[model samples]
Target: MTSPLYGQMMEVPLLASSLLSHASRHFGDIEIVSRRIEGDIHRYTYRDCEKRAKQLAQALIALGVEQGERIGTLAWNGYRHLECYYGVPGMGAVCHTINPRLFPDQIAFIIDHANDSYVFFDMTFWQLVENIAPLCPNVKGWIALGDEGCMAQFRADMSVPVQSYETLIGAQDGDFEWPELDERQAPILCYTSGTTGNPKGALYSHRSTVLHAYAAALPDAMSASSSDAILPVVPMFHVNAWGIPHAAPLAGAKLVLPGKDLDGKSLYDLMEAEGVTFSAGVPTVWLGLLSYMKSEGVRFSTLKRTVIGGSACPPAMLRMFEDEYGVDVIHAWGMTEMSPLGPLARLNHRQKQRPLEDQRRSLEKQGHTLFGVDMKVVGEDGRDLPWDGKSFGNLHVRGHCVIDRYFRREELPLVDGWFPTGDVATIDADGFMQITDRSKDVIKSGGEWISSIDLENIAVSHPQVAEAVCIACAHPKWTERPLIVAVLKPGATVTREELLAHFQGKVAKWWIPDDVVFATELPHTATGKLQKVRLREAYRDYVLPGAVESDA
Candidate 1:
């Protein structure tokens, strides 16, 4: 029964450690620059990172970190954080990057749920560790991510057994060899933002992580290369910083870690000082950087492309970066479930040849799926929808890097074979997929759906609007009506009538909001996405104008 159809090849397992090792040997002199927490610049080569990563592996082993045990890190995008990215998984342990912005109780819940043996944290987050120490029963000890100088403050603030990072690693030798493990073994554990309930974990395997790194570094993906210097403003805690930790070294690109200073001026300073050629982050961070540049009349020297994701990037923001400045905005979309990378918004040759207006619109859609990933939008009857561009349905993806099941959860989230993305999207004839709205956030008015994202996109295009979030308000006639909650730019004088008028003729006449409310600011989740769930609660009782007259 044996057929000769299978051509045999070398069956070497892909490991995250191999990325750093290759970079160290080939691009040893390229600097992995960091703006340290101590408010100073720290520079080291890939060779140095590889050496330190080995030492960190030894330190973890000395601490009784067994294979498959979860080791948590509550830190920023810095050098020490990067060490844990490679070192923990290098020894078959899972590196669980906990977001520091999460509520203290949620952090404790994650630590207890994951049964983390130890947590390595930055000194700036000492107080947060102190607050959660009592609740995190599984964490045996804490290690401060700084020198001996931080021990004084850590000892005073935290009652648990704690030590400095340098002191712990200083006693270890860097001669440890990375173990060869099954490529399917988990390397990193990431949790969703957990807006509704406890955050769920996505345990990424060595094979998937390594594969994602290659996809992210591809010419049409992140386009990372040896000649590029990438600044990952996106924190490592957020889906392994969108896989840059592995992708950077995998491509031999120079890395510039911006510690915790993400403000516009701080980011601008670091990019200029480091000659950062490419970067990636959420829209909220880019807005600040663009605002700073606008106000100060400054510009980027070495920066070129930036990947905008975590949330949808406004078309206005995309145009601003490409038109005003020379930076290319690589609009991207993904979920924590998909190893945080789906279709990147990088354009190809045929699409580039389209009319300028058509090209710009295509750019707004999440780019065509990368080589290894496949996507389909399905309708209510559980059949695949057409790619004619007019049909909107549930978005699902199946790929080499997509998750099979969440960590510790018995339920398999996949439908048939594809992972449901919980997003309503449409894929066009040319394979460009556009996300219309999240399944829960879409508005059904008069038995027809209105896309909140589309409305928000149009609203923000107004000159006075800085940020806008559209939510469904109760409607007496239509059952639900569209209403916009917007934040005006500083010193903005736009009125309710003026802002609402801006939306005219842009969308379906019914798609426009019935009323507009100016807000000083809007609440956001820890991941910097607009908190529509919270806004729904805040405005549940507020009557829309049409409903107000009918109710009276």
Candidate 2:
């Protein structure tokens, strides 16, 4: 006979609501700062955030938003949006954060796809929601995220039920108790900003989200802590702002949410005013900040560290941050499917001991994976590639937070329990992964693979280039050739020969672009990623110079 087990531990669920409760109890005095849409700074404490969140929860329940129903939010990062993050999930309802920057069709599709019962939007998006409301029949009500008078005119104009966000929560009491919910219950939903197809939803469970927050707070990850003041420049609608919304509270850190005004001057003002220690955003956002700082001869007073992701961080930008600004730039990479927290480019002890140049090179690559995540690269034949840093293959990842299947999709996008990330990458012996290119965007020239990302990074490093992209232009002999499209800084000029000469000794001669094109501004996605697809389409029919074959 088997012996019985000893004492049983508590069976508490890892719901997101618990994070808020812990923050309120342990770090109630911590500040939650925001630059409101009305162009003013709004400040509150964690205790206030928790009380308001509970009141919002009561309001949600009173509005007949049942368990498992979807509550969509079309707003920027701010105190009210943070309340929605907790209140919607705390009440057992799924919080669907709609990206307002997405195309109108995509926004409408996502609203209908999620069957959102109520949409809480800010005054900035009033006209957008007004125009798209008729298309989203499933959306039961519209709540403007403002004071009672802010929405009065809109409410009077609209025939549907339009209410004020502040009034709704103010009418409810904060005495409501959170119900016991399963850890695996879906709490948040985010859609991918995929380049090719329509956006797909990645529904995150309460357990996955909470675990991601913990992993993101680790020293090697985002290194978030109570002593740190975080400024998340990344929009809240983008992958839960890379999980900062939860990770900040989980670590009891002070949060500074930048709403709407993402300009360099505005961000600089907030960082200096709030004494922000850490910030996170895409490369474009940082580029603007760095430019503004340089042109104005401004210096960072309190900003010390930044997390650059959404696209590869250029070596020039990384060096500028580290060498000139004395700030640590953590190069991170992840996807909406993986709950958006994966490898962070922080050096271990051994890596730190390496030569400065070697360490910088490693930092140039995407850093090692977090504790809970597993990564691998596979060839076309389903064989695992060696981690020698030379062999590149399809990148695949799996973990507690990775998605097994997309929401409402019948087919599972997995292979042997791993989700293919649709990226071509190489992993070194140290387990550092470097994304070479997207599988679709890779230029195949004379049966040899040229990484468009590598070329673009190299080209953008040029002193005169503000932005650059490499696309495959059709060729007669090689079937395809790389063409560099560059956007020069204001009043900056460079000849194609000079730009081509810059690639000398940096990369193979064949890898260099045969010709260069200049543009005033390059296109970018809603999340700030370069839109190469449009460039490819625009140059699809252009023939290579001195080509032997002509169009038949």
Candidate 3:
């Protein structure tokens, strides 16, 4: 109310400022625990993390890191990563998170593209550090974010000066003052997984990220609270661990970081030990953990809820967690452009009393849009469609946080304020949105779009199938058609005939897969989503029964 433009500018403090402010004033005693180099645990409180981040700020200043400079980090989820999350941004520098899983060339490209001047690495990434060091021209220093023993080889390999993270922090006076930051300044940069085209980067502002964290902590979203110990199985490199690290402190949640080792046993052990009640990740992690729990006879005493996104979770997996393990699994859907937490899959108050099976059916949707988001489905003519569930169209999303441009690609597609999500979806009467398929992944047969996801879901519903991938293969008459590739479960056998028969009553006859191919496994994306593009490439020459190949 002070100024006419004050309404447009939400005068919230910077993300680092808010994170430190909360930790110091309200939840100083909340614990932040990490698994250490030894077979032991290192524990600290929010109070300790705040002090350490300040010490890190002081050390960065001592090392001559200037404002707006890029600082890259290759680290796993741990208290140290958390420190950099706040410390780097607190010093008015952008935190460039390097995904260790990316191909070496891609990794080199991101490092150079960001023009990072300083690098930090965990002990696990020493060899990788050696590999890409030469390509980073602007980088002048290497900081080993681990113990002194781990820094020996790293320091020797680095052409520039190298310092141990422990020694640097120990040497700092911890008397650094926080920098004044404009809320609109870039706080973080995340690149999309380049499956369709070249990877594109999206810059996030301090204000935007802080608002996203607040929205993420809503009851309809992650619903985090101070009493909760949160475990984000999602990687920190991906959309800021879906903004958990930022949201956790704002809500006073105790944080648990499962550094490096994300295997089934390690995650379960950490979850159990830390009393983690809620977690989020892609479906693959939960599947692996479920298998491990059955094989090792391990159970989560505290983990009661999991938020699954990045791909559609198998209904069976959702059922197993809900029915067998007494854990609730909620399916979520969003893109990197939307700051990653766009829609949450939750039943409304009216649907809460529905039958369990009916309830689960509703929960499988991407759920209703969040508070500040708006969605519309557009037809080929760019006209809006009714929310009748049966009317499918390309989904267009527009919001304050939705990205309007890629970092450097001014020519990339944009229509008005709306960003085409490149996803085809159907909105039900109840306002829940269900994604039919990605635009590029849809199979067109006889001029009708067939959702590969729908076919794969049907295929996996059969007891014999362990996993299924549907991709379009060149068709002589139909132009393009879907071929279902199925991976069978152990000791299970189902022929193509039997599987086709399962879809007879479930879907339209024409929508049935033209052919079914048996396989041991389906390829997956770097983030563990099913790699349909690879599947299409592998079967581009698929031959279906009674169809002839054309030279044209």
Candidate 4:
């Protein structure tokens, strides 16, 4: 005979709509700000956002959007887009955010693959939508996120029946009740920018998204709170703007959305104007902001912390933010498949007690896991590697937010219940995870592996170097040797020998790049990660000097 369990609570489903409801009820008066692409500022409150979201939901329902159907958004970070984040999922329809930065062909492919019933886009992407609309036959209608005049202009230019987002929502009242939805039902779909082939969709469940938001708002995670004015320089299309869209509302934080104006001056001006206390973006973005601020001798007044991801944040960047600007740079790591947030680099109390230099070194790592995610490194033979801070292996993660399978694909990407992250990393005894290299980008020289990330990081730390990437070049003796492709700061000059000399004491002699190639710019992905695949292709036939072909 089994005993009955006591203290059981109500079995309410963890729907995404609840987040909006909670924000409206508790943080109704908090401001949600947006710097629009039209060179203007749009301001509203949580109450307004929630009401508009409900109106949008009613609009979608009137448009005949069925439950669990996919609705696509091709827009920037703004209040309207934020409304859809709740509106689409809140009504049990999946929100598929298409990255307009992707190639037109890729965009068409994604729309067709998702079979989106309707596509909502901004005025800035009018030409893009017009170009790709014919390619995506599944898209039944189009909604331009603008006023009636803007919609009329779009309609005049296109053959499709385009509706104005404002008109549709304004026609509806906000009294519609949200339908009950299973927590495990898919509510959001984001595609990975695949290095090869087409992008694959990562359909996220309501439960996973809500859990990720909770974890992201924790003290060790993004540390989102009501007192902070949050600025997400990261685009909303990129991993839900690193999950800040959800986490900000959940924490009742004031959100400052920089819509398509990520330039240094634009970002700096907006941060100052909004009194931004915390922000999140990629290293390339911060590099520009730092350069602009340094050149102007300007400093942050209210900005305190920033979360850097999309790629590894260099140690020099971490230091510059901390030492010069008095800002904390939190290095983070995640992928599209993991609701895009996992480990965040925040030092514990004991770790903070160490020497500043030592603490900075630890902070340079990707970070330790958040509460919901579990990580481990495994060797080639599938055995778990030791967490001694030196053993590098393929990183594997399992968590409530981790994806078990891709959207519309039945194949499972897991190995023994763990999702392989394709990242070569080391987990130290203290739980700090450092990414040595991408598994495909690791440079092998003379039967030993060299970290391209390390080489790139060290090169960028030089005062004159603006950006850097390390790629493997063919060598006769070593088979493959590291080559540095560097972009210099404007008007700055440095010799290849001088650049190589800068790495002399920081890394092993063999790990240093054998040669340097100067360039005005380097290619990067839409999400701001270094496009190493393109770099590898560009330097594929390059031969290292003083090296002979191996006969064996």
Q: 267-335 in candidate 2: lDDT tens per residue? A: 998899999999999999998999999999999988889999999999989999999999999999999
TM-scores, each model vs. reference: 0.98, 0.98, 0.94, 0.98
lDDT of each: 0.91, 0.92, 0.83, 0.91
Q: Give candidate 3 misplaced runs (Cα > 4 Å).
A: 1-14, 37-39, 153-161, 549-552
> To one decimal, what is the Cα RMSD in angstroms of model 3 from the true structure?
2.5
Candidate 4 whole-model C-alpha lDDT, 0 to 1: 0.91
lDDT of 3 by residue, 310-357 (tens): 998777778888888899887888888888777788888988998987
lDDT, residue 270, candidate 2: 89
* Tens-digit per-residue lDDT, 1-552, candidate 4: 434765566878887888888888999999999987566899999999999999999999998998889999999999999998999998989999999989999999999999999999988898898899889988988898888875665567776667889998999999978788999998899998866789999999999999999999999999999999999998899889989999998999999999988889999999999999999999999999999999999999999999999999988899999999999999999999999988889999999999988888889998889987899999989999999999999999999999999999989999999999999999998899999999999998998889999999999999999999999998877889999999999988899999999999898887888899998899998789999999999989876666553533
- Sliding window of 10 residues with minimal summed lDDT for model 4: 543-552
Model 4: residue 178 alpha-carbon error in angstroms:
2.0
Clash pairs detected, candidate 3: none
TM-score of predicted model 1? Answer: 0.98
Q: Candidate 2 local accuracy as lDDT?
A: 0.92
What are the clashing pairs of model 1? none
Candidate 2 wrongly placed segments (more than 4 Å): 1-7, 153-160, 549-552
